[model samples]
Target: MSFRSRGPRTVPLKSAEEVDAIVRKIRDDQTRPENYRERSLKLHGWICAKCGREFELSNLHLLTVHHKDGNHNYNPPDGSNWENLCVYCHDDEHSRTILADYLAGKDKKS
Candidate 1:
């Protein structure tokens, strides 16, 4: 008698805590890249992108270091097109897709 069985050639598993920790580390690195904060502030002229008005460094609360091409890791490649979006605009952009889906679902339910 001959038998053949096939399963995944390779499978990797990590505990939930390990996965969470890895994700948290990645997010932390992205949000606080080395020296990115200081360089970006100067590059953006210390102004709110949406308002186009100057603000003190302290007023730069909750500012998002926006990635113009939607590639957060791409690092702008150059300083030209990168922008500093305030929290309001940043959150708006980030939530657009989720908001659309939510609205559509609500509409269907109602």
Candidate 2:
């Protein structure tokens, strides 16, 4: 007597055209800077994520949306890639990222 064994079915990969379409859709979605900022503000409110500074409607312009992973083209629908930062904190955060990269390069060289 012989027993038959079942194997996992393989899923079909996306065609090149389908992949390109998906990439274009993602790029279009992420390139909407204004929409992401509005959605981030709605998700995180008027408080700065870094410094906890609060903004009122009169000064809401001071609040800016920062891309957490440093990739401006990675905006997700859940606002996971965003943080609301006051202008000062946003500047500082970028400065820190630059400094960290420089230090890492120096360490690698050493």
Candidate 3:
């Protein structure tokens, strides 16, 4: 039996409005403050600042951006407030802060 040749594949076209919307969405996403994670990683390299743990793309998710001042909205473009922390180290750092607050009576029920 002879094999038949397949025809060229056809793609659906989007309207100009749809294309414009897609471009605007991409631009907004690029400008969002949440991108600080990427900026921090680039500025600090792929190592945990507290534990000195290195990360590769395969395990990058284990690395996280920790804000120095405990403010999620305080991301600065200069990378002054960000540190890359491995999940374990980041948890320990926050736990220490909580423990300090508890010991200092900051979390009193009054």
Kindly give the number of clashing pairs for every candidate: 0, 0, 0
Q: Rank the candidates by TM-score, best first.
A: 3, 2, 1
Model 3, span 7-99: residue lDDT tens: 898889999999999999999988776589989999999999998989999999999999999999998899999999999999999999999
- State which candidate, 2 or 3, has the greater lDDT: 3
Note each model's CA RMSD in angstroms. 14.6, 17.1, 6.3
Where model 2 places Cα greater than 4 Å from the true spot, the runs are 1-34, 106-110
Against the unseen true structure, what C-alpha lDDT does each candidate score? 0.72, 0.93, 0.94
**Which residue pairs clash within candidate 2?**
none
lDDT of 1 at 54: 65
Ten contiguous residues with the weakest lDDT in model 3: 29-38
Report the candidate with higher TM-score, 1 versus 3: 3
Q: What is the lDDT of residue 106 in candidate 1?
A: 60
Candidate 3 structure, TM-score to reference: 0.75
Best by lDDT: 3
- Model 1 — which ten-residue stretch has the worst lDDT? 72-81
> On a 0 to 100 scale, what is the lDDT of residue 31 in model 3?
78
